[model samples]
Target: MGRNTRKRRTPLATKAIAASAALALGGGGLIWANFYASAHESNSGQNQTKAAAGQVATISCPDVGQKLTNVPQRARRAVAKELANLDKQITEAYARLASTRQAQTRDANFVQNSIVGPLKEKRAASLDRIRLDIQRVGGRVNTSGLGSLAPCTTQPADQTNAGGGQNGNGGQQQGGDQQNGDGQQQGGGDQQQGGDAGQNIGGQAGNGPVAADFVDITKVAANVQGKPQNGGQASTGSFTTKCGVNANKNHNTDNVIVAPGVTNGAHHLHDYVGNQKVDAFATNDSLIQDQTSCQNQGDLSAYYWPVVRVQDGTQDFDQNADGGGKEGNVGKILTPVQAEIKYVGNPQSKVVAMPQFLRIITGDAKTTTNGLANANAHWSCTGFEDKVQLTEQYPICPQGSNVVRTFAFQSCWDGQNIDSANHRTHVAFADPASGACGNGFKAIPQLTMRLVYEITPPTLENGQVKNAYAVDGFPEQLHKPATDHDDFIAVFKNNLANKIANCINAGKQCQ
Candidate 1:
């Protein structure tokens, strides 16, 4: 198939043909009926385009001879069992293909290259295996049905019910001559599992920020008129806690939330920096017990989020490209030059322990267009301070300095909930003018993260560099450099929080 050629109607057409055969056979007919009806209903519009493009093909099931009258009863039973297994496997392969395809938003080429092609190969191999098994049983296996398998060409019209159904068992002929028994494939088993799994897989590809009311950093910065207030002079003691290199152990290529029960995480890939063991399935209680890579053994906090990809143009990071999703290549996973933990007294000059299970988010992951929402999602250079800007276009840092990404979370807490509905309501930024907590809020130790990367200069395309760095993000954002964001969760025990508080309040710089 050509790189741009699409096979959108093949899978559905195949399903429809299979359903017709099931109806004729009088077993498992309802299962196929339901599958065909759902698929057709969801993709009616796309089907019209598929028909016009002449991409749909007619598939016919071959006439495999019924159980041989002269064949031994035992042989008949064995063949029936083998055939049933093959049918089940074929059904499952298509079901999985449908589910995965629905989740993707990449162009036709990408579906053909990365996803559809591989799935087709697996199905073909399974069919071949089934043919061999039938030959061993002195039965002739018809291979005519194999020609219709093809790649998906068109994008699905609606994905609301993408992973809704499960593959049902194909009805098995009990005895060679007897009519096929009415076998009802169990429902609610695999369908529920697939739906839940789809939900847990991360990287939702869509337009702009997920939240409707996200605040831009530029606006926040502009609102502040004076230097950040430290409230009052620090007492005599202040302390610093440093966490050692906790390289993200769960370096998952699939960006889905793997936390227990929550399977859907990120759809696009993300570089998880801290808490090596962090995954989609991680929980507050589990994180508190996990050992810290921090030098301070008592601190067991977890911090992680998506990664930044340094795109030297020509790389297929474009979301519009055929066979492309977000960034085309996985890109390099840059380690932070430095990772540490520190607690500082809030503007009130009072250091209070952070509440356990506190979940704070810094920067907007969904800010694709607005520059203000990405103010704190900073990108800077070691020497070129004058070139810093809030736009998605990143400057080519001078030869000496590497690119730096700094994310700072809110420091004031509401003192009640460990986490709010939006992950930000419980915490608010300190007053830009006074650097003090708001009326109902209390000052807590501040958490800041700095991720440094050694990005090479952009590769020129047609005598000009168009896009240099492509940060990982939703497909709708086009992998724009500005959508970068980070997350932090406080899992410190009360005793540890108190120690951090004492260290900051006492004005001691202890690491």
Candidate 2:
């Protein structure tokens, strides 16, 4: 991917595994359930078999957007919209797949002939639009490789794999250069899905959050490290910004940084904090002029992330709407009890102020199927901060302990572009070992956030997880915790920006 997504590449090969994800309902209308497994420490653990005969779990396609790194800047917006359209096509097809189970059982090729084949055709059309859009902008693109991305395939929902799930780590082992240094950087093949996405395969209709996709905090090998792992040269101060936990209830399905000007671009709900007016149509000028929810009047920055929901047979206001139940995201939205946004110092050196309107997206929303190459999910719970941190699976916290979701944005900037065609090349995560920026990259006040939610612990019934909570995401994304992500845009006034940089460098914590 672009600049290797962090200085390395995996050879641009996309393999939609043969047993990746699953579907819920089966023959005779029985529901296939998702269940958690006993913790196993090694990658060679024996898997317990649960596949019913001839069951095709879920489908996956290669991520085309990550490959469009060479699209000219002039064609980016158009290409982005087309890419969003491609994702929508997949979501719609997946919904159709979920709704038509009996048909899938009657004829083995029914899914391939009626669903996947037609989807490939639809995707091919969208791919053509992308190619033409690039050509119209005087950007040449190979036509042959683009067609290969249009095909999708089915996997039997990789259930109960041996060892540390897949790739020697818990479910959905992350690609090394993903978001932050939340845990040990896993190398080699676990980055993409093969067996992990099928662990506990439970959801609206067998989407995901596989059993192995979760872990009991008591058993996880403590992977969290103490602060400032870069040693004595680090700048160790913080500046907390008190933005109430979205009490204003600002919500939308738009992503201004990635798919601006396209309504319902996200295809999933997002709870927004800080700048009050941000949507598909928002401009830098509009953001700068809009009111903010932050206590600091000078910081109009917008922060947002996918909403988490309890799948307890309840429905929210958007239950029947497009980004909600219709797209497989059905459940009540949980407002955070505490949403603390702050700027922290670089662990290796002093930081610099960021320019206004700087945009950054941390984590990958399509991690369930797109692979964990950009995954940055840091899931934990209150009162267990020192015990462990999980990047792939969600934590089933004990009673009285609320759930915690944290986001630490990329702190190193390219010193030029505020954003990029892929929205990532201009910024990168600090090296996990050295806490230093990449070549030519400069350190900026690192943005970090913590959200706390008081949710009742989900219990196991039969093989199903009752009251299970999952993050909102694309229908094809399976609502897995691996897809959890966040976004930000710096609309801060110069004075506040300077204050943040000064406080970080001076080694003084400020509000």
Q: Which of the numbered candidates is closest to the native, going by highest TM-score?
A: 2
- What lDDT would candidate 1 get against the real structure? 0.40
Q: After superposition, how far is residue 420 of candidate 2 from its true place, in Å?
A: 1.2
* Per-residue lDDT over 213-298 for candidate 2, one digit per residue giving the tens place of the 0 to 100 score: 55455545555543436456676777898878987789998898888888888988999989999999999989999998988888
Q: Count the backbone clashes (under 3 Å) in each candidate.
A: 50, 7
Give residue 31's error in model 2 in angstroms.
Answer: 17
Model 2 stretches astray by more than 4 angstroms: 1-3, 6-54, 159-201, 204-206, 227-233
Per-residue accuracy of model 1 over 141-162 as CA lDDT, tens digit each: 5565532432322222111111
lDDT of 2 at 174: 25
Residue-level lDDT for 366 in candidate 1: 42
